[model samples]
Each structure stands twice: as structure tokens, then as C-alpha cells.
Target chain A: MTETNQAIQLNQVNYSITGELILKNITHSFPTGKITTLVGPSGAGKTTLFRLCNGLISRDSGEIFINGKSIDDYDPLVLRQTVGIALQSATMISGSIFDNLALPLTLKGEQLSEEDANKLLELVGLEKSLLYRNSKDLSGGQLQKVSIARTLVNEPSILLLDEITSSLDRVSQQDIEKLIKRINENYGTTIIWITHNLKQAYTIGDYTVVMMDGEVIESGPSDLLHNPKTNRTKKFVRGEIE
Target chain B: MNFLTLSLSLVFVFIPIVLSKVLKLELEKDTIIATVRSVVQLLAVGYVLKFVFDSENMIYILLMIILMIVAATHNARKKGTSIKGITWKLVVTFITIEVVTQTILLGFGIIPPTAQYLIPISGMMIGNSMVLSILFLNRFTAEIESNQDAIELILSLGGTPKQAIHTQLVNSIKASTIPTIESQKTIGLVQLPGMMSGQIIAGADPVQAVLFQLLILFLLLTTAVVSSALLGFLSYPSLFNERKQLLKKITTSTSDTEKS
Candidate 1:
């Protein structure tokens, strides 16, 4: 596929820390407006890749294009605004839910009205009543919902989720999955979700990318999870490698 | 007091050392070292102060102030090692504190231009600012470590570096400054301030001693705010890179290692 169709393209991307290479010449094209799940073992550098994509960490030597434009061409702040990220550790600032949801705009010296905050809460499957409640009082599931809501406040074109449902109960996980699917269908937000659950990767992703030791093993249609071409991808799907 | 009188004061030191020994606290060694160091250092400073006073030269006064600042900066900089260029940051903050406090004190004719007034007041101001800086740095680093998730949350949401660290910075400033404010509330009631008691023991009138003590008390408030707020502002920018990425670790001595 051409660069025009790809939301993000990493070409010969390399990253290292403390003289140890974390990512070694990673190259891939992530299609726009699709759910792409990255699956791998614990130290696969999945989260680091997302950080690099969002410009939270710079690549050592490589080029990453966002929507056919060089990632470096965009201002870091604006790039982050364009590409929102949410971590699994759903921490809340010591304030009301409204404050947490409005934080992105607040940082930009703009005010988010109560009505708009309520809309975000509603969109996240949270009660509009929760808007004025102290965020620290939220349950784990509620916190994650609010975290996603906060990320959505920026109206990002691409969403990077780092194990957002890893610690939740079954019901919460399913609810989050449904919410995410609805978000993708409605908004067409290209999402790169990092998950360890094979079932989740197979079920939720339109495309599945397998990573091992900082290299892409295989990426194909999610249906390929049932019959992957590479032995590594098969072992990964069979729960033998991890 | 004469040398004999000063030597007699060692009895107070012995009391602490004896108590620690009886309690098996293992603080006796530390106490002894502290006592010895205080005696030697203070005596040296005393002689130096006497020389500066006797000389009555502007250069000597300035030299004494510089020495105080160097000592203060060295002592305070360790607490803020996570801040880049912390050595220079502390120096700038200390120098600014000294200038602002002294400018007001001398500018308003509240104190004399003599070394007697200038040296001691500068010592107290810089010393207090140093303590405040340590307190601020300690709390700031702790806040950042504990709130790393929250800070990155803000950054990933397109918040500026200053915006991302805003909550931690404000909390640190408040935490450091509160002790100064609270201690002043009880001032004379809670305990005799050292400066006031010293002036009284040296044959100054009680009212005059208190007035001087109030001046020092007021000066400390300024030191508390200026030292903490200025250091916080200067240190936060170093916590992020040009891409507005929150460094996984912020340290002055080494580059940050990103969280894999």
C-alpha cells in the first residue's frame, strides 16, 4: 500500500537506551481508521513503539511518517494532540472528573464547560452526574473510562492504548471492548492497541501485528491469527512462545 | 563570654551523647562529630567575621557574602540533583534571594551598611533559603516519582511540559513554604528565637532584640517563597525534552532512560 493510505509508517526506525538497542530497524505500515492490535511477549517493545509514534520518545535513527507527513514535521504538542495515548495505569488527578476530562484544553489555556465535560462522560458510558464528583473516588473501571474520555477530549485521529483493560474484571473488559469498537466504528479513529490476550487480539483487531525481540514477526489480516504463515506467529497464537 | 565560659557549654553536648549511649541509639558518634564540627567551623567563621568587621572594607563584606552563598549552594544542590544544571540553579536562586533581601534591608535603611549588619543578615537569609531549597527539592522529586503516571497522562494529552508538571511544582512550593509560615505563627510563644535570645544575652535591650528578631523572621518568609518558587520554575523545564516528552528519569548527572 502507498503511504497515503497508511496512518503511520515507520521506516528503518531504531531506538536504544543505555547502549542497548530497544528497537532494531523496525519498519511497518499501520493502516488508517482500523483497529491494529500488537501482540507479543512482555519485553517486545510494544509500548516503546507507541511512545515513539506519539513523539513521547525520539527514534535513534529512522523516519516515521504520520498521514504521509514526516512525524518530525509536526510540532510535538500538536502531534500528541493529533495522536492521543492512554496507559493501563488509570491514574486520576486530585480533582473532579470534569477537571480530569477538561485537562487537555485546560493546559492550552482554554476552558471546558460543564456541558462539554458531561458530554465526554456520557460518551465514555459514565454518568453525567460523575462529572462533578472527585475523580479519586472512581472505581478502576470508571477510572479507565474517564481516562479514555480524557484522551478523546483532544479529538485525536489516532489512539494508542497500552493494555488499558489488563487489570479489569471480565465485565469491565468486555464493556471497554464494546466501547472501543463503538468508538472505532463511529469515529473511524485509527487505533493501535497493545494487548497480551490472544483472544482479545483476534477478536478486537481488524489487523494483527506480531512482534518478538523488537522486530515485527508478521502482520496480516486478523483472520490470519487462525493460520499464520510464520512459525513464530503460529507459536505466539498457540500460546507456546510467550 | 570568655573561652572558659564557651568551654563550659560543652556540658550540653555531653548530655545528648550520654543519653544516646544509654539508649543504644548509635547517634553518639554523629552527635560528637556534629559538636566538633560546629565548634571548629563557628570559631573559624567568628574570626573571619571579626577580621571583616575590623577591616570595614566593601570588598571584605562582599567576599564574606560570596562565601556564605557558596556554602549554601553546595549544601542545597544535592537535594535537587534530578534537576539539570542544579548547581547553577541553586546559585542563581541563592544570589537572587541575597540581592532581593539585602536590597530591601539596606535600601530601606532598616539595617546599617556595616559588615556587622550585612554579613550576619546575609548568612541568615542564604541559610534559610538553602533549607527551603532542600525541602522544596525533596518534596518535588517525591511528587514526581509518585505522580509519574499522572504527569505523562497530561503530556500524552498534548499538555506542555510546564502544564504536565504544574501540580507537582505547586504542591512542592506549598509544602516547603508552609513550615516557615506555621513556625512564625507561634514565634515568641513556642520558643525563644535564637537571634533574639542571643541579642538579649549580649546585653541588648529586650524590645530592641525582638525588633531585630522580627526583621529576620520577615526576611525568612521572603526566602521561603523566592527560593522554592524560583527553583521549581527553573527545574521543571529540564524534566521534558524538546518534543515535550517526559523523560522516564530526570537527573542532572545522567541522561534519562526511557521506560520500556
Candidate 2:
């Protein structure tokens, strides 16, 4: 948890499944207390890299370190608890909203009280009255908010978002963006946002990294939108090309 | 025993198949193929059974029962390859049930080791056990794979792996055994059972055949429940490693393509 420890570190990571390389030998560090957005075109290995960090998928070679410790050193259960993730397809289980939000905590053997559940609901801009509703009945945007609240229930050190707002309307998308900014600013949670939208990335990201065909093409502060260093980055920002 | 009646019965086997096709659902081919295979295989066994009944050799009856158990085990193993050491597990389970049931029947002097008692009773038990094991194993494996994330999430939150998979495991066993229970309950009321009808056709008194069928059905209920429960409990541990992490390699799904 030191400044040099880095919230997440990928070192020469190369991942392949069945002879097809999905992620090349790419090295990067997600520094603590900052939001890093991984922007790339379709099939650019963004989700694969996120899964590797969360320990959902294994890497064929190289190592990933979180908080100065190699991924192999930590148990998978511990890694999941420390690094929470929300899938692009925000799925809610067959349960009430309270049960959905309290799932991580309940599994951890912490008895979930009504007050704590209400507080978590309020954090996501959801009213306390909605806690007892069926999770499947929630709107798309509401489900994503509940999913984020569930991810935060255990207070993970790093939160990995994989196009969480891609399926939402503009207003819902903005609501999620504001929520993400609040979570990062108030809780000091290291955020790794993966998206194809340049505008959203420019709005929320502190450090923006552009990936294309499994390689990092360019990376800099969010101000790079004003003066992009790479032609690919500029074209992508202007919607001239994918 | 007329050819016309037997031909008519063949048409009856198509009821479930035709219904499924008209509904335009999946599993139509599997159902048809399974039904056809069962008919052909059982017809061959029926011929062999006629010969065995005439000979009335105890060794022949015992061998036939053993063969049925072996076939049942093989079928169950094919469905649950994810459960490690499945061959041995199947053998242990079927053998335990066969020995226990055979002993109880023989002790009561129901029909001695004659073909009359051995073939039909063992056939009913073996067939029921096979169906039960297939249902239990398939459901168990599918449930585990589908709910893997939820299970892992629970484990990370402090639930033991056994505790995490408890609901799914129980649900699988319950689902597998419920049909047998339901059929047993509705036996003489809703439908005339196969064994009872067969017995009455072979010149046994109706009441006596009903009693025998009832006993066999009760034994089947016990055997199916016990075997399914045993299979689920014993096979579940093989899906996880010593450190309690799920082993992804142990999947019952045979296809190489990964499901999203």
C-alpha cells in the first residue's frame, strides 16, 4: 500500500488460449489513488487484461502484482475480495435487491443489517424503498448502479469497470460517470475503467492509455485529448477511424 | 402376444417424441434417439431373457444382473466424466444397491434365485438407477459450472466450498429423484406400471402381480434415492482442489469451444 507499491502492476504479460495470442507482452502500472482508463477498439484485449488483474482468468506467461505482491502469492479468494469487478453485462442474481447488495458481505460471514443495506443503497443514488424489490425488475441503469454497490460492499482496494455504462442511455451514462468520480475521490479506491468512448474517458480518466491490437499505442494525462501525441489517438478521438 | 398388439405398442413409444417435436423445443433429437436405442437394445435383451428364463440357471441369472449393473455404470460414467474416479464410484454404488436388495428379496423367499424373480426385479432396479444417476450427474455438473462465480464469491466471503455448493448439490439430487417418487405415488391410479402389466400378461394373478410390482417400485424408490445422493456427495469433492479452489479442467461439457 505504499506509493511505490502501485495498486496494480502488469509485467511483460502475454496471454493466449489454444495457440491464439490475445494479450501480447505488455507492461503497465496503475498507480494508487488515480483513475486509469484502458481505451481500445473491439477485440483489443481490454477485457482479457482486466480479468487477469481480477484473477478471473489466468495468464499464459509473465506476472501481475497488486500492492507489491505477485498475483501467484495471493489466494484466489483473497484476490477476489481485494479486487472487485463488474461485468459489462450487468447480471443480477435471483434475489431481492437487498440480498444482491449484501451478497459479498453475507458470504464473508458479516451479518447484514437493514441500516447498512440502506446506506449502501443511498450511496448509489437508489432510494432505500427499493431495497426489497426484485433485482430482475430493476431498469438497466438501476441494475448497473446496484452492481457497483455490490462491488463496493466489501470495500475492495481496486475496482475494475468493464464498459459498465455501454448499454445505458445518455442520462444513465452520465449518472454512472458521476458515481464513479465520487467513489474514486471520496474512498480513494483505485479505478480501472475500460471503455470505447473517448468523451467519457476524457471526462473521468486521470491517465488515459490507448491500446490497439494488443499493444499500448499511446498514454498520457487526460489533457492528451487537446493535443494527442499519436495519429491513431487523434483519429480515434475525432471519430474519424476506429 | 399377437404381432398386431406388439406393433401397436411400438406406436405408443412415439407419444413423448411427437409431443416434443410439435412444441418446437430442443432435446427432440436426443429424445427420439434415446427412445429408439432403448427399444432396439431392450428387444435384444428380451430375446436373451426368454432363453435365460427357460434354462433357469442361477449362474445365468446372476450373470445377467451383473451385466445390467455394468451397463448402467458405463452409462452413468459417460454422463459424469468430470467426477474423477467415476468408474469405481459407479461400481461401488450399484454393487452396494444390488447386494442389499438381492439379499432382502432372497431372505423373504419372494421367488428364490429363479429367472421369474431375478430378471424382472433386477431390470427394474438397474434401469431406474441408471436414469437417476444420469439426471443427478448432469444436473450437478451443469449447476456447478453455471453458478461457479456465485460459488466462488461465497467462498471468498468466508463460506466453505461445501457450504457454497450445498444448495446446488441438494437441488440436483432432489430433481433427479422426484420423478421416481411421483411415478410411485400414481402407480395404479394414473397409469398401469410396466412391471405390473408385464407380470399380468405372463399369466400371474392380477392381485399378486400388483403386490409384486408395489414391492419392486418401493425398492426402486429407495435404490434411486440412495444412489443419486451417493453420486452427488462423492463426486462433488473431485471438482475442487485440495486448497478448495474449483478446478476448471473438470468440466462435464465435452466441447472445446468455451461458453461465454
Candidate 3:
């Protein structure tokens, strides 16, 4: 199969749980080297969509192509390493931060020297002193950062963030947003960020896709927030309805 | 004696009900059903054991050991559902422990291969090893399943699956062996172990019986630890495939209930 120019391409993707469609027929393409924010309310299937891309959940009917090849062609383990994900509820193993960060690389059979891990920690804005600390002892924000660092340890081509900063304070949120931007700009990593915060979406997303009831309502450049064609999009962007 | 029997029967019948009611447990029916089943099974086995003991046939003794193996297999399978090749694994465990303990006993001339000596000693060793196998397998399976991510994390970090689960396996073996160790410690102090008391009643000298009992306890403790650890290590590999993904198919039907 030939690779597509898009980082991730979904064609007629449909997912349901217990016969209720969580994500309806959806077709979209995420461009390479760009930050795309999937904005939706709760139950809008944002998380399910992430699962579909990662092959954690199978679609009832649809095809997902990662980097132009069918997702089925890649082993799930390999796919996970290539397309790293950070969950909203960051689950840390009961171990030190160094262990957590080294997990993906270890699982992928990649060599991770101490210096490499230390450098990755610094990239995620974590100090070398935090490496020995137990992951459970870290605050929510610090843990999220650790999760991000762990996901990036393999240096995946694409990164998926599922509401990673929704629980953070203003300072932590801004700090992570800056780190994310730097990662995208410096490493040229494709980013798919899911969030409910339209302000954050506008601030960080190069492209924005707004979804409701398992369907994409509108999608365009981030600047399209200034001139939304759909009334629902306008209402959502203006906070008139959630 | 009749009064004693009547009082004993009454206490046995009503004590369970009183305890269940006091504890506010909703398992009255289950408890009663299980108790009845246990009583019937033990009674049948008791008579069969008596016949076997009297016959003094080596074949009958061997048959009894086979039966013990089957029972142990059932118990081990029920506890470690994820274990594949369960029957063979359990048989290996049963045979290893039984052979080792019996050989040492007979080699030392402690129990002259008599049906009386063979049956009870074999029973004790088999029963203790069965319980240990169940404990070790159950704990090992549960720990691996619950801490799967941690295990995978370690594996991904260049640790082999065996290396990743080594600590958990050791912990499980230790957990299963502690009871036998404690029982050994309390022998002849807080409580008389069954083998020692039975030997004394069967016309053996008290001091000689004590020495023999200590030897049996040590043998049982060693067998239980080795067999349980071996079974646990052997069975755990079957839970995951060559690629290290957890196999979803479990052998035992009761596993779902235990997992929940």
C-alpha cells in the first residue's frame, strides 16, 4: 500500500458500543507537521476516535490509514510506538519517574541511556532531580508531563493528547501548551490534541475540527473561529451553548 | 457418651447458623449446602480409605495417590484458569512432591512402606502441596493480571517476561509457604499436628513419633515450597503467549467470578 501524504486519514469510520453509535461515519485527514485539535462536548466520541487510531478499539466499519498505509498493516505494538498517545487520566506505573519515562522505549526494545532519558526529561520541563521520585508522588500536572515525556521517549512520528491539560491550573496548562508547541515546531511531530477548551484550541491548533453527536460540525483553519459558517459552531465558540 | 454425642451434634448444627446470623452474612444456604456436600464426600472417602488401609495392597495405595493427583489437578485448575496444559502441569507437580516425600520417608526406614504409614503421610503431603499449589497459582495469576502494565513496562524496558514477573512469583511462593512454616513452628507447642498424634495413638513411642513427625513436617514444608513454586513458574508462561500478550482464554469457568 502506498503511503498517504496525510499523517492520519479516516474513511467512513464508524464505532459503536452495544449497538449505540459512538462515532458515526466520519471522514477526515490530519495533515503532517500540523497541530489538529478535535473539539467536542462529552460523549462526542473524541476519546473513542483516539482508540480507533491507536487500534485499542476496532471500528464497526471504516478504514484508518496511518501515514498512508492501512493501520491493519502495522502491528499494534509498532503502531503504538510510532503513534504515541497520552491519556487524559494519566496512569503511572507504581515506580520512579525514570521507569515510567523509559517504559515505551523499553517495550520497543530501543536502547535508552541515562543521558538520553535525562535529556528527554529536560525537554518535558522536568528536572533531573525528579527522576528518582516515585511517579505516584507526583501531582496531577507533573504526572501528565511525565506521561508526555514517556510517550515521546520513542520519538514517535505522531503524538495524540487526550485532554492532557484539562485538569491543570492556568500556569501548568500554559506551561504544557508551550512545551507542546515547542515539540511540534522543533521536532516536526504531527499532533492530534483533543480538548473542550475552544480558547486553547484556537491558541494551539493549526487546524480545528469541531464535532457534535459523533459528526463533524465544521472544520477549517484555526483562524476560522473569527468567521464560523455554522450557527452551532458560532454558539459553541461564543459559549452560548455547550 | 450418648449425652456427649447429642451435645456435640447440637453444637455442630446450630453454631454455623448463629455465627452466620451474627456476622450478617447472606451465605446461609451456600454454607449449609457446602457443609452437607463436604460431610457426604468425607464420609464416602472415609469408608474407602478404611478399606484401602485394611487391604494393604500396593496397587490400592498407588490408586489412592492417583485419585489424590486428580483432586489436586481439579483444585489447581480452578485456581489458575489462565494455566494451559493444566492436567499435565498438575500431574507433574503432584508426582514430584509425592515421590520426593515418599522416597525420603521410606529410604530413612521411618515408615516401612506399610499401608497405614503410606496413606496418611501421602495424604498429608498431597493435601498440603495441593493447597500450596492453589495459593501460589492464584496469587501469581492475579498479581500478573492486575499489574500487567507494570510488567509490560519492564518488558519494554529490556526486561524479559520472566525477569519482570520474578518478584511477583517469589512473593507468591513466599505467601503460600508461610502457613506451613508457621504450622511447623507451632507443632507440639500450641497444637499437635495430625501425623504425630495419629502415630502416637497407633502404638508408636512418643519420642520416636515426635522425631518422625518433625521429619515429615520438614519434608512436607520442603515439598510444598518446591512443588508450588515449580507449578507456579510452569503455569505462568501459559498465561502469556510467545509475543507476551496475555491470552484471553482461561481454562476454569469459575475465573470470571473470582476476577469480579
Candidate 4:
């Protein structure tokens, strides 16, 4: 696919820490306005790859392009503004949920009005009343919703999620999944989600990429989970191996 | 100030030793070692100060200051083992504190340049800043370890490095400097500080001793803020790699034991 059609493109991307290779020459393109799920076992470098895409972390070698431009071509802060990321267990500063939601705008020297903050809260499946409540009083699920709402305040073109539902209960997980799908459909926002659950990847992913030991093992449509092309992918999908 | 008077002070150590033996606390060896070490170190410093005073040479003064900074950096770096290049970061901050404090003292002619005055004042400033450095390192490392996700969350949302660590930096600096500020608030009422008491015991005028001690206290306040701020700024970048990635090695295990 050409760069113009892809929201993010990686060509021979490599990353390492302390002389240990984490992502080895990864090359892939995440299509614009689609949900791409990255699935792998622990230590497979899926989270590291997300960081590299957002420029929160740099690749040791090769090229990563966002919107057809080299990642290095844009300032990291600017790149991050365009490609927002949310971690699984994020912390909120000691303040109200409104304060947390307004942080992105505040950092840019912009103000977020109460009406707008409440809008974002509703979009994330949280109540408008939660805005004035102290974030410290929030449960785990509510905090994650707040975090996701905070990330959306930037209006990023692409969003990267790192197992955001792993720490929540079943109801919270379903709520988050619905919210993410609605965002992608309503806004045409490109999303790259990292998940350990093969079922989740199959259920929500338009395209699924399987990774192992810092390499992309196979990448195909969500249907690939059932008819995996490789023995490793079959074992991974079948829960026979990590 | 005489040898006999100083020797009589051993009675204080003797009391602690006897109490430890009677209580079967087995702290006798530790107490004796501390007493002996303090005596030897102070006596050695006293002789060195005398020599530096008599020489009246600039190089010797500068060398003594450098040695103090080196020793201070070595001590403070222990608290921030997770930060890479921590020794040099501490050295930079300690040197900054030394230069700024000494420049003020000598430049404004607040006190004379003679070793008798310069040595003791520099000692107070360096000693206090060293303590502040250690406090900053401990708090900064702990805050970063605890708030790693928050910091990354900030960074991933277009916040700059300064913006990302700003809260941790402010908290660390505040935590490190609050004790100095609180003590300053209660300076005279809480207890007579050692310098003032020493001067009063040495037959100095009560009012003059209080004035000089006040100057030292003010200097310490400046050292507290400057050391905490400078160390906080200098040490945070080391917590990240060249790629701006927060290094995973910084997390201290829950069961990790520190030697000191």
C-alpha cells in the first residue's frame, strides 16, 4: 500500500535496549480509519512498538512514517499530539476528573470549557457528573475511562491502546470495547490496539497481527485467527502455546 | 577548646556505652566506633584547617573545596543507583552550589577571605547542600518509580520532557527542602544550634554570636533551594535514555534491600 493510504507505515524498524533486540526489523502498515489489533505473549514487544509509533521511544534503525512523513521529520511532541497513546494503568494527579480531562489542552496553553469536558466524559461512557468528582475517588474502571477521555482531548488522528481493559472487570471491558468501536466508526479514527486475548483480537480487529520474540509472525484479517497460516499462529490462537 | 576540656567530653560517649551494656542492647561496639571515628575525623580536619589557614594560598583553598564536593557527590550518588551517570549529575549540582555560595560570600565581601572565616562558612554551605542533594535524589527516584505511568501518559499526549516530569520534579524538590524551611521557621525557639552554642561557650558576646549564626542559617536556606532545584533538573534526564524512553531498570523491587 502507498503511504497516502496508510495512517502509519513502518519499514525495517528495529529497536533494542541495553544491547538486547526488542523489535527486530519490523515492517508493516496500519491502514487509515481501521482497527488493527496487535496480539502476542508477554515480552513480545507489542507495547514497545506502540511507543515507537508515537515517538515516545525511538527505533534504533530504519524508518517509521506517520501520514506519509518520516517520524524523525516531525518533533516528537508534535508527533505525539497526532498519535496519542494510553497505557493500561495510568495515574491521575490529585484533582477532579475535569482537571485530568483538561490537562492536554492546558499543556498546549489552551483551556477546556466545562461543557466540552463533559462531552468527552460522555463519549468515553462516563457520566457528566464524574467531571466534578475527585479523580482519587474513582474506581479502576472509571479511572481508565477518564484516561481514555483525556487522551481523546487532543483529537489525535491515530490512537494507540496498550491492553487498556486488562485490569478492569467484564462489564468495564465490554463498555470500553463498545466505546472504542464507536469512536473508530463515528470519527474514522485509525486505532492500533495491543491485546493478549486472541478472542478479543478476532472480535474487534479488522486486521490482526501476530508477534513473537520481537518479530511479526503473521498478519492477516481477523479470520486468520481461525485459519492461521503458520504453526506458531495456530498454537497461539488455540491457547496451546504462548 | 583545650585538649583537657575536649577529652572530658568522652564522658558523654562513656554514658551511652555503659547504658548499652546494662540494657544488653549490644550497641557498645557501634557507639564506640562512631565516637572514635568522629574524634579522628574532626581532629584531622582541625589540623588540615590550621595548615590551610597558615598557608593563605588560593590553590589550597580551591583544592579543599573540590575535595569536599567530590566526597559529597560520592555520598549522595548512593541514593540514586537507578539513575545512570548519577555521580556526575551530583558533582555538577554540588559544584554549582559551591561556586554560587562562594561567589556570594567572597564577591559581596559579606565576610573576609581569610581561611578562618572562609573555611567554616564554606563548610556549612557545602555540608548543607550535600544533605539537600541526598534528599533530592532519594525523593526524586522514589517519585519517578511510583509515577512512571503518569509521566509516560503525559509524554504520549504531546507534553515535552519538562512538562512530563514537572509534577515529580516539584514534589521532589518540595519534599527535600521542607525540613530546611520548617527548621528555619523555628530556628531560635526550638533549640540553640551548634554554631551559636559553640560561640557562646567560647566566651563570645551573646549578640555577636547570634548574628553570625543567623548568617549561616540564611546561607543554609539558599543552599536548600538551589541544591534541590538544580539536582532535580540535572538528574531526571538520566532516568530516560537517549531516545527519551523511560528505562525499565529504574523500578526497585518491593523486597529490594539497601545497604545504607
RMSD versus native structure for model 1: 2.3
- Best-fitting candidate, scored by DockQ: 1
| True contact recovery of candidate 1 | 0.67
**Alpha-carbon interface RMSD of model 1?**
2.3
lDDT of 2 by residue, B150-253 (tens): 66555544356676788789899999999888877777888898778987889999999889877888799889788888877788788777556566665323
Off by over 4 Å in 2: A1-4, B1-63, B76-119, B137-171, B233-260
Residues B27-138 of candidate 4 have per-residue lDDT tens digits of 9999989988999999999899889999999888888888888888788888888888888888888778778887898799888888788778877888888899888888
Best by TM-score: 1
Candidate 3 lDDT by residue in tens digits, A1-242? 54566999989999765566778899989999999998877667787787667654467798889998898887656766678878777777668988777767655556678898799889989889999899878999999999898888767889989899999999999989999999999999999999887889998999999887788888989877778899988887888766
The docking quality of candidate 3, as DockQ, is 0.13
Fnat of candidate 3: 0.04
Docking class of 2: incorrect
True contacts kept of each: 0.67, 0.13, 0.04, 0.54
Worst 10 residues of 4 chain A by lDDT: A1-10
The clash tally of candidate 1 reads 0
Ranking by TM-score: 1, 4, 2, 3
- Candidate 3 docking category? incorrect
Say which candidate scores most in lDDT: 1
lDDT against true structure, model 2: 0.80
TM-score of each: 0.95, 0.80, 0.76, 0.89
